[model samples]
Target: MSDRQAYSGMAVTGIDAKGRAAIPAFLRAALDRNGAESRVIIAESANAPCLIGFDPAYLEANRAKYGSRADARLDAGETVDANAARLAFALNDIASYDSSGRFVLPPFPAMKAGLDKTGPVLFAGLGDTFEIWNPELLEADAKVHPAFKERALFCLSQWKKGGKG
Candidate 1:
């Protein structure tokens, strides 16, 4: 990915002694430009056993995109987009990056995101946001559907090779 982009490329990083994972240097710089300094909004991914990280600006945008009716809908005892509500709730946890460009993953959220502090973790960038995943979990799921795995990986490869995707 180019230096001018939002976030892209991928890596396998290790969680440190303090349950911290370093955001890739390139991504960090991008985050800075995008108005996220030492802090970021992290949440359990809606459709994956992983953690999703993005700038607070995106969170605000998300709230607006989903419209101002979310709260009203919930108050009416209606079934709203649960995932969006989940994402909205996740905004309560604002994560901070250390001097070394790492962010601590609280134990509860880490466990929920499928990390057990014993294996390499995958970092996948998806433009507006990025994800941290247990590599084995992602790999195992990839095996469940041939087309899904192939298409996803092919797109990832292209993005890593400098395509916009």
Candidate 2:
């Protein structure tokens, strides 16, 4: 990713009364440049306590890992596609940005992530995608996550070194 395109900072934003939050201009530009303007997917994060929001192009590009777990289930001889469906749609929500470049989070996805009208949120950039977090959850993570600063520094060092880290 180019310096301008790289998602590397945090933006503490809030949900409006209409259930929308402005995606930082940097992220919005990157998404538009990558042709991800059509849809934004919001869902409960499988890896953390927060929510993750990313465009479909990223999803499509990482299909083997992000888009499908059905193959594994089939190999395990699962009787139905319940697990696969759960993996795919358990927190799945399809959204679109408004005229102001703000994404609309539906009720289910918003509530699942503990975001409601007037909730405090954090927009954390994770390179290819970004994560939307509840401030409380983010603070909780910071307290318990021992290597947060070291990991952050390491990423900066790697970025400076021109390694795709």
Candidate 3:
């Protein structure tokens, strides 16, 4: 909506024993359009049991928004919570992918997102950011939309049947 390249579509990919996963081609194209580098900030989603990935531009936009809000609160004689701001950025990990779109997920963020060390990872695009989900975790999440839950289940079934997720 703001002229930013939106992340769209969904893909299910495998994560190896060492937490390596490839960004799907569609999402990679969107990232390329938004940033000069093949790097993204992967963070635990505040509202879901999953990880969220966004390009540097998105992170900068968020930083600007946070700064403006903090300034406004200060102008209104309100205390700015420096610790809160620090925590928000501290939990994120910057991951750089190769030309093939392969990147290693940091152990902490991967665990926080409920991703298994080796399993299928579901990438769901949600406009500004995309979600990295452990298909099983996603299937078990009651808060996820019914359609997404169905999709996750379907992907898992396909993976179990020796099909690409």
lDDT (10s digit) by residue, model 2, range 56-138: 76666555664345566667885554665567665577788865578787787678777876755666778877788766665
lDDT (tens digit, per residue) of candidate 1 on 1-165: 234357786766667667887877767876788778789777877687788888777777777867668767878898787776665764446889976678888677788877858545667778989887776577677433565445445544554565632
Best by TM-score: 3
How do these models rank on lDDT, best leading?
Answer: 3, 1, 2
Write the residue-wise lDDT of candidate 3 on 113-142 in tens digits.
878588888898999999999887887788
- Candidate 3 has an lDDT of 0.86
> Which has the higher TM-score value, candidate number 1 or candidate number 2?
1
RMSD in Å for all candidates: 6.3, 7.7, 1.7
Candidate with more favorable, higher lDDT: 1 or 2: 1
How do the predictions measure up, each by TM-score? Answer: 0.72, 0.70, 0.92
Give Cα-based local distance difference scores for all models: 0.71, 0.66, 0.86
Q: Which stretches of candidate 3 lie over 4 Å from their true place?
A: 159-164
